[model samples]
Target: MSPSNGIQTVALAGVGNIGSPLAFEFLENGLTLSILTRDTSKADLKQYAEKGANLVQVDYSSEAQLTQALRGIDVVVSTLPSGSDDQEKNLAKAAKQAGVKLFVKSEWGLDYDAPNMEPVNPMIASKMQLRVELKEVGPPIFVVSNGLFATLAFSSFLGSLDAATRKAVINGNSAQKFSLTAFEDVARFTRLAITRLPIPPAGSSRVLRVQGFAASFDDLIATAEQVGGNKFEVAHKSYESVADKQLEPSLEGLIAWLLASLSDGRGLLPQDKLTHDEVGFKPSVDIRKTVETVLKA
Candidate 1:
């Protein structure tokens, strides 16, 4: 790892799927890591505490609790999911008050920064709004514009693919290029962002557009079929119709909206100028490997 980069203690606001891998990355890098959550009884939270993380439970509604947890933290990262805007706002306030040097926004999906990439629904809108509010409320906001979590497309809940049925579906024409990032790669890139690059302070934010690889859902299906020794029949959906059904709110609804957002090619990262080369993050997994993982699971 590169020498400190002026960051000493790193604190995370939540430790879900994204946060879990990210926290481990920080810890493995020898950075001082703290995990902030409201629940200490969770088995996962307990594991972090065992792994040398300062796992502190706090009531997000209480400013004192938030402030106390943030004291002496150099960077405060929100890995909470999209809906927790209020929690993120409070965390940013606490980070600022505690003199944290940077506040990282919890955006681990999509190139929503791309042109014409409007929010398809309230969830995506909330994520975008949180980034804006964080700029006004916290230290420098660090955003990684990773196009999509590679695992999302293969998830059973997203319903894009069925291993048993050998069938697959996608938003867009199934050939619109978009970036896909693995969770561990996201963590590693994020670690690089904080430790190996110049992070801005409050009033000015930093955005890095990075990806594991760029591929279409068709590419993913091909990869999966190759890895699994089977072929997948494919179907396509439009972004407009898929976005409409997601207003009811469910896992299926959310993925439908996410898939729809990709229809117009807004899902893609700029092919000419991806930030991975500048940031120096060589992804550990690509589309084929990511697909292999999902097919196995």
Candidate 2:
């Protein structure tokens, strides 16, 4: 830890959808910020640099470069896209070599601890592999199991509610509940957790399951209808039926797998309790407001 603030420098890797927002949250919370990206020419780098983030460009495949970039960092947050499991493992190895205090893995959603749960896609399988690798590494780890991102829930990304079509394809029973957390909320909670949570002893870490809201497919459709002032044409599909149809090769297959998993309660976090409350933080985003914002967008 840096002597000045008690908590030393923080570094973020792969500043994409989740990473970018998390970077801003860390910066806003008054932490020394550094960003690692393979490409320096990305336009967002300029914005991050302008906001006082130290931008370090490095080849993800080069362990030497990664070790050098992570040197002297207190915490490392990886928001790398799914399927980059090898890269995440390599980065973890580099972080451990560089003596990083904490490494927050790239698990932003789902309860990977679920028993007998199989990966619905290659990306998910890679994430599971990273978890296994981290357990053998040196740095203290933190995993945030924040169910489905609210942004994806309202968008077509999850294949649940289609905003453009004003249609919802509910899988399994519409009454089955699941969790949803906004990108901003996840970033906020992450900032708090990384900076405030006590560092566990070596070979020990915590998985914090948090969410902004919990709702069923029927609840989501109802929220959409209420927000849009129009009833959406709802269609019910069995989880197996939808999963089989989306098995064709394409990105949609991945989406279908996620949707079906959520519908079947495979990857979703438990909704019976609030992890954020247990940790003394409150999430303010509600399902109705989230739907309205998405509809307005």
Candidate 3:
């Protein structure tokens, strides 16, 4: 099938943070949707069935099982966590066997295409391996790369900001820029791409990039202060001090590399590359708004 053929069905694998909202968006649009899950007994999974989804229980480890479940799916979106590259690779093989017209890789962040790009965060290794394996594979794929999820712009997990202590840490200067998008907006834009994008014959490589708004680390700190109506103790560490070594496979380590990339120019989209406007989405939340909501929560 091609982009002009229109989408009749969409199957989403993995329903955590990004997956849950994406499932709801597809169902809300009244599409024929299938949700993949390992367990059918969860009450949380039942909600989508109530919302008119056909939940298929399948072992992601088995390519045959995933292929069978994906038999009639026009699109397969892998929202599996970044660490699950092996499963995603199997899913890709299955997608091809099942003749899935389009496979949407969970390409939500970073400039993976950057020259000299290292797996600063170990989780990114999954994406890197998938690309090397499938860059020329069939069942033309789709990727939507929006910088940081706005909800995570000031994530305490990154140790960049401690909301409780009101302390902000920076690597290098605060002027390093990166992008952020609200999670719901990501769902909306993914839906748009389903229609606006074409499924090229297998062997295609491309990425669709978008950003809610471009802001710097300093912008986040200031936004936090304004949103919370409290001042913060801020610190700046040299880039060498921040990213001189391999990051451990922890949330804080991954976040540190991500922040360091911003300063070194590996964390953001290029000037002419942003396509959110072309895809027709204006993010509902900006830096200030997301910080306000997150801080309030």
Candidate 4:
């Protein structure tokens, strides 16, 4: 099918944080959707079915069931968790066998193609491996790079700001900018790409780069303080300290590496222009408003 043909039927595998919103976006765009879930008994999963989505309960390990569920899907969006590489590979193979036209991978973060990129995060390393494997045998893939999810940046994941303690950690240069996208914006842009992105002629795929906002850590801290109506006690962690911590073998090391990467601007979009220009859609989320909402929540 050509890009001009447009997407009609879409299937989503793994509807959690990102997938749930993407499924809603697909339905909001008036596209036919099939949501594949392992647990149909969950209230959230049932809610989608109640709202007219075709819910297919299947085992991720069952290739036959996966292929059968994806038989008529024009596009397959996998929003599986970071460590679910094997499940993603399985879905890719099923999509190829089921003749799905497009396969959107679960990459909603930093530009994997950035220069001198290293697998500091094990999840990113797994994603890189999946990309290579899909290129060789999977269906046509669309890689969406939406920088860091704004929600995660302010959460405990990056260690930049602690909502609980009302504390902040500044890594390296406080003025270095980092790209961020609200989770809602990610869903909206993804829906546009799946339904409207032009199909490559052949032997090619699409890489989308998008960001909701870009600001320095200092700026983010200020935003947090303004939104939360409280002053945070700030501390500094040098890049060398974080980088050295990253060299250790543990989850803490992984998080340290991630902080160092974001501090040094290694895992962000290379440019300021949003990929929405290519899709002809404008993102509407404001970073300040989003931070305020998150803080209030």
Worst 10 residues of 3 by lDDT: 1-10
**TM-score of every model versus the real structure:** 0.92, 0.90, 0.91, 0.92
Candidate 4 yields a Cα-based lDDT of 0.79
Question: What TM-score number comes out for model 3?
Answer: 0.91
The digit string of per-residue lDDT tens for model 2 on 207-231 reads 8888888888788888888778899
Residue range 179-217, candidate 4, lDDT tens digits = 888877899888877767776533346778888888777
- Model 4 regions lying over 4 Å from their true place: 1-4, 201-203, 247-250
Q: Can you tell me which runs of candidate 2 are displaced by over 4 Å?
A: 1-5, 116-122, 243-253, 271-274
Clashing residue pairs in candidate 4, if any?
Answer: none
Name the Cα RMSD for model 3. 2.6
lDDT of 1 at 16: 79
User: Could you list the CA RMSD of all candidates, in the order they appear?
Assistant: 2.1, 2.8, 2.6, 2.4
Q: How does each model score on lDDT?
A: 0.79, 0.79, 0.78, 0.79
Best by lDDT: 1
